[model samples]
Target: MNRRHLLTITAAALAAPRLCFAQDAWPSRPVTLLVPFAAGGSNDVVARFMAPVLEQKFGQSFIIDNRPGGGGSLGMGMVVRARPDAQTLLVSSASNHVFHPLVSGDVGYDVREVLVGVSMLTDVPTVLAANPGIGVNTVPELIAKIRATRGGFAFGSSGAGTSNHLAGELFRMRMDLDMTHVPYRGGGPALTDLVAGTIPIAFMNLPTVAPAAEDGRLKIIGVCTGERVSVRPNLPTVMEQGVPDFAVRSWTGLFAPRGTPQAIVDRLGTAVREALAAPPLVARLTALAAEPIVMTPAQTDAFVRQEYERWGPVVRSANISANG
Candidate 1:
């Protein structure tokens, strides 16, 4: 080869690694973190609260898209379709994965197909309550009533397939009883109806339901966790009473399209993990009675898949459906 050609070829080889490194760095631009819930809700609030820190660390804006309907299925649908370029992330939690497919079969995306990006957040524990007049004072009492009534009691939840709905369903499964579930657009309406006795009982987020339990609108029977939440130390856990190894946790996390590079997922996960460990964020989450959950992308993925499989039988045995 001519000297000029050889020199040009040598230069090209040297520059390729730098170019590849830049391309694989992931997150070349601002990332959109989709929150499949209303603005100012727990998930959205947490997303916005941490967006600034992520932007500072990643050198890109972390925008939020609030798509509230079908619980969290709609926003997750959008995330599943987006390119796996680390530019998009879904702020998913337990509700989105556990209840959507169980209640309705046509969510249009196999959760397995969409790769888990990061677990941006999670709640401390789930909560189940009765609006009173159910004549149940504790978890066992409620279970006995359901057993006697043959699961005929009415219950309200955020939506057909939400973490809230799954929490209630799983609780029923453990007790071996059945109940009618009333799905609402969101927790706000569900809580209103529960207090009005339109629905006798329900499973809801702790943050949303704790106030009612305090104000006497709804009676706090038990927390759907293995241990009592420190924020409400007076509350007892369902497991502490009778059932063993029964814990239903509702959490919010982030997801991305499949095949998104590990580097990007790791980057986002690392940022979130670090942000969660921050004292200021920790204090804020504690005050809100929301625990900051940080997990590796793999850990988050496994947790979601387990919930999906675990809730399948409970949904089937209950015969709960979208139409119901």
Candidate 2:
């Protein structure tokens, strides 16, 4: 009575995993790429740009979900809790995933531990700008003014633990200044404050602040790249402005929840390489002035690690906190 039943149950148990794997079929359903910022933002733009191509490649709907809040912590937390299936991914940037976690005391997830990097999308160099009323024209003059004030000035960032925050903190440490960091919800708000005299200075992505600088609302003190950006050759870099070896570039990348199948990660990485290589996508990125970057999963992981190491000390030393 029991022998046949036992054999059947055992066979079924042995076949269960394969059945589940078959069911997975990688995006048997629509895939969601969570953009942890407002729509039309850089991360969102990248996600939207790639969505259709990914859908075409996989023959499934590729949806973009914009969950912007907590300076990117909110959407990140959602991704952290999502199933390890390949369907849910985070289209993220350094602001929240890398720098935010360093400064934020309790973000509920470590980016490196809970998410696996798929590929880096783009790289944007930082720019240090100031309100025209600050009366500073160069990095040296800015430093001198801060010193004269006994480090009394204040600067603003897109938000706590964002690239802007870390860049500002790095500049403060490198220059031995004592300016306070004011965190806003996004770069737009920070730039608004800078132009309105609510804050005297900011370190922001070049694209976000360049227009204001050109219009004379804000003055470009220096770029944070190792060399002058080709598009802005007239603007000197911080390295040439007496701060040696100081460079910061913000980037966006694709990541899946930890425990996702390596095969899925590799597949996604290949798709990313294909997307970036497309001439139309490349032209769009070029038009937006974003430098497209490609990285394998291993390379992306190592790059994220390097970023954490680079910014961790600055965040800790500055005591940057999302709550504070």
Candidate 3:
């Protein structure tokens, strides 16, 4: 080959890396994080608090685009179809991403195609609470009663394909009982109905149930985790209550469209971890009624994939769907 041609190829190869590095040093413009749920909710608050910190660190505005509809699917679909640019991202929850996939298969994006970035959030446990007037102070007792009755009892969830719904299903399957499933359109409605005695037992998320548990309006039977949470240490876990296999927790994480440069992924992952580790940041998240956790890009990908596989079959077997 001629010297001129060889030099040209060498320069091209070197320039390719520089181009990639340029992409890696992203957030040159404003970064948009799409929160699928509406504003003023739990997820919204977390996003609102973290946006300023991220903007300060990266020197780029982090804006939240609220697109609430279809049980958090509308916004997710928009982001999934967007360019695989590091600028467009999503803050998604387990139930919306995992359970929704099971119930609504037509969602525009495939779990395998979306790139999980980093997890900056986790929802506290929804205690296995029951009204004492129902004669069940613990999960086992509730299970025993439902079993003895041959699944005559009814339990409510936030909505179809929601985390609250899956929690009850997981418990029923674990205890080897046949409990009827009743779902409401949203958590607020479900909780109201539960307190009014329309549904004797239900599994709502932590902050929502905590007030009732403390006021003697509800009896917490167990937590749906591997270990008891420090927030409510006295309560036992489902595993601790003898259903060794029962475990479920609603969580959220940041994600980018697929094919984003790896360097951006690494940088964003580190930023999320550092943000969560900051004491003041953690304090703000706690005050917002959520937990801020950071997982590396690879770790987030593995966790999301595992959950999708695990719940895909569970939802199919239980015949849980978004359709009423």
Candidate 4:
């Protein structure tokens, strides 16, 4: 070969590895963290809280994009279609994975098929509480009160097809109660109505109503988890209150579009695991009544599959639709 051609070939060979390295070095640009809910909601709160920690770890900006619509399907759909480059992620709760698909007509993507779970951030227990004026101190008492009122009872939920709403539906079916389901725009409004006695009872996230329940403005009849949360060990579980097979847990996690590079997934997952363990982050989540979770990517995937299997039948049997 001519000297000029040989020199050019040598330069090209040397630059190839640098280009490959740049391509493989994930997060070459700012990461877009999608929260599939309105701002100021639980999902948004968790995403905004974790963004700074993750940005610090990766040395890249983690911009939170709130895409709220269709009961969290809009933003989640965006993640599903995003390139599997680890730059786009969905920070959402169990509702998006388990309930939204089950109820919404077409969520545009199947989480099981399109997304890979990285790790769960927290599990927020659902609480069944009533206005103090309702005078029910336990699940059984609440059941009895409902019976005495002859189907006059009404319960509020954050919105239709939400974790809180399904929890209330499960309670109603398990106990065979005849009560009206009142859907509110959000949990805060529902809780306000409950505290004002406008709504007799509500199945809500513990964080939203814990203050009122603690101060005796709202009477917490039972926790809707299989086991009582550590933060409220004194409270009895609904299962223990004579209701069989009643459990509902609200959780948030990080997920990337399916087929993301394993190396990227591993690196991001480790950062998340580290962030969850940070003392300041842990303390902040604790103050919000959120329990941090630890799980490998495989484990996170399995957990979501199990939840889908468990809750799918409940939603199907109830014939729950997003419209109602």
Ten consecutive residues with minimal summed lDDT in candidate 4?
36-45
User: Which of the two candidates, 1 or 3, achieves a greater TM-score against the reference?
Assistant: 1
Model 4: how far is 170 from its true place, Å? 1.2
Tens digit per residue, CA lDDT, model 3, 88-133: 8888777667777778776766765665555546565655667677
Higher-TM-score candidate of 1 and 2: 2
Which window of 10 residues has the lowest lDDT sum in candidate 3?
A: 37-46
Best by TM-score: 4
Give candidate 2 regions above 4 Å deviation. Answer: 1-29, 59-61, 132-136, 144-151, 195-197, 210-218, 317-324
Give all candidates' CA lDDT scores: 0.76, 0.83, 0.74, 0.83
lDDT of 3 at 264: 82
Q: If both were scored by lDDT, which would come out higher, candidate 1 or candidate 3?
A: 1
Candidate 3, residue 312: the lDDT equals 78
lDDT of 4 at 148: 89
Clash totals for all candidate models: 6, 0, 0, 0
What range of 10 consecutive residues in model 1 has the weakest lDDT sum?
A: 115-124
- Pitting candidate 2 against candidate 3, the one with the higher TM-score is 2
For model 3, the superposed segments whose C-alpha errors exceed 4 Å read 1-30, 38-42, 68-71, 103-108, 130-137, 140-154, 173-200, 211-219, 238-244, 284-292, 316-319, 322-324
Q: Write the per-residue lDDT of candidate 2 for residues 96-142, one digit (tens) a residue.
A: 88877877767876688889999998887788989999799999999
Model 2 TM-score, 2 decimals: 0.81
